[model samples]
Target: MTAGVDTGGRAPGRPRSAHVDEAIIEAVLGLLAEGGSVETLSIEAIAARAGVGKATIYRRWSGKEALLVDAIASLKGPPPEPLGESVREDLIRLLSVGPKKPDERTAQIMSCLVPEVQRSPERYRLYQGLVEPRREVMRQVLRQGISSGELRADLDVEVAVAALTAPVLIQRMLRWHPGLDDESLPARVVDTLLAGLAH
Candidate 1:
């Protein structure tokens, strides 16, 4: 699990409440689902929605952008921990977990947020920072496969990572294609890539 955000200036020994954190995060997502943008979301509005004080939110996050990043990350949770038993199983497992079929609200929020993030470089960087750790998880899995002689030694890990992830992302985030809800998708993707990657 991702560690709790550092409470930079909080008094020593004052533990943050998980309940409050969750409420605040939920409030941000709720606002976004209601068509709130990063620019328009205010600390006061979040605090009011979450039923907490502005000071409570400020103690946890420097600003709304930082808070928004964390809120989005919470939706995905952490990257799956690879089993390390085999590349195919691990890759499939990694891909299989998380929201397979986004709810209507989630889909609506992503539709708006995706373009907004792309248009703002700062937001794009924050989004990249949020996703890179998950990509690193995949990279590590592919590297292990190569080391164990399960994958071709010369396989381009970066390319393979993109190839393996892009379809699911497109379907889930953009809904540009059908069949993201297919339970067998992870295995199918792994198998298709393995045909060329396997040693």
Candidate 2:
């Protein structure tokens, strides 16, 4: 029998063996969440968990860094839609929804990357490519609020964007908290931030 043979047989939309590609991604994510840093993440481990061969993973990624970069890039969700309300409300909505357990693997990788971001310009650029678009989405929403007169025209949208996200990030990165208390965190952030921006 083939190494990846489907003894149970294949179905429509399913690969002959398991879908090696998806398994690879899942395996990588699991490792990352399990406190495996980029340096610590091994291709062998990924292949083992994925139930795919080493060559299969290698055929897709040039190296561990490249594989990690792709995996991390895929993990992000698109920027959220703006809620129909005041800037404070919208911000609350934005920050309220986030990873419940958070990805420990990604966290470990990022912790390592943060300090080296300056030293590795290309790596930092890759990070920005994945993360910046999300920030821009927030910026656009804030700008729209300003134009619609929902928020003060004098508001520094960029600064406000940071203010909206900073606490959430700090809590996750520093304390390793799971998801935020949606009922309170978002509302509190909105209230405090709007106090500075509301005209």
Candidate 3:
């Protein structure tokens, strides 16, 4: 496949191929899913699975954690926008709908990353890179709902965002639940959160 080079136009070298990058990420994800800590993830295992040299992997990532973080960051896409006019509809839409499907790789990485996040505080930067941009989008919609009188004006949108996502994450990662589907999750989350936000 293609190789992954930094494409922010920072350097002049061979353009990284998307195919190679995908393969490397897929390989790293599979290893993490198999269950291992950051220290356990080795360049040899990754190179073997990805069919690339260790030097090549190092060229892209400084270490296993960096590589793993980058791999997780690649799996996510933008979240959906609010469609209906009211807060209830907006909450439901934001919670339940998205433009892309969540896959096993994402689920696995998230499962592993939770523990990593707890052990290392500095990793929030990586987590933010992977998940926060999408959160920002939802925050804007929540602000709009408040402005339109669809939601209570004083509700803390930041806390509200955590309330929306933290439960699903806990259920999936800790309680061993099958995890909520997008369709039903929104309605439940909206009902619960709106109850608290309502005057």
For 64-125, candidate 3 gives per-residue lDDT tens digits of 76777666655543446667577677766666543245555556667787778777767766
Q: When superposed on Cα atoms, how far off is each prediction in RMSD?
A: 2.6, 7.1, 4.1
lDDT, residue 129, candidate 2: 66
**TM-score against native, each model:** 0.89, 0.72, 0.75
lDDT (Cα, tens digit) per residue for candidate 1, span 43-84: 999999999999888888877877877777776767689989
lDDT of 1 at 113: 83
Screening candidate 3 with a backbone cut-off below 3 angstroms (N, C-alpha, C), the clashing residue pairs are: 2-19, 2-20, 3-17
Position 19, candidate 3: lDDT: 78
Clashing pairs in model 2, backbone N/Cα/C closer than 3 A:
32-105, 33-105
Candidate 3: TM-score?
0.75
Error of 3 at 88 (Å): 4.2
Candidate 2: segments with Cα more than 4 A from true spot: 1-19, 59-63, 83-86, 101-113, 116-119, 176-183, 197-199
Q: 1-103, model 2: which lDDT tens digit per residue?
A: 1132112223456344335656787788788667665667799999999988887776666667666666655554344677767666677767765554445
Estimate every model's Cα lDDT from 0 to 1. 0.81, 0.66, 0.68
Query: Comparing candidate 1 with candidate 3, which one achieves the higher lDDT?
Result: 1
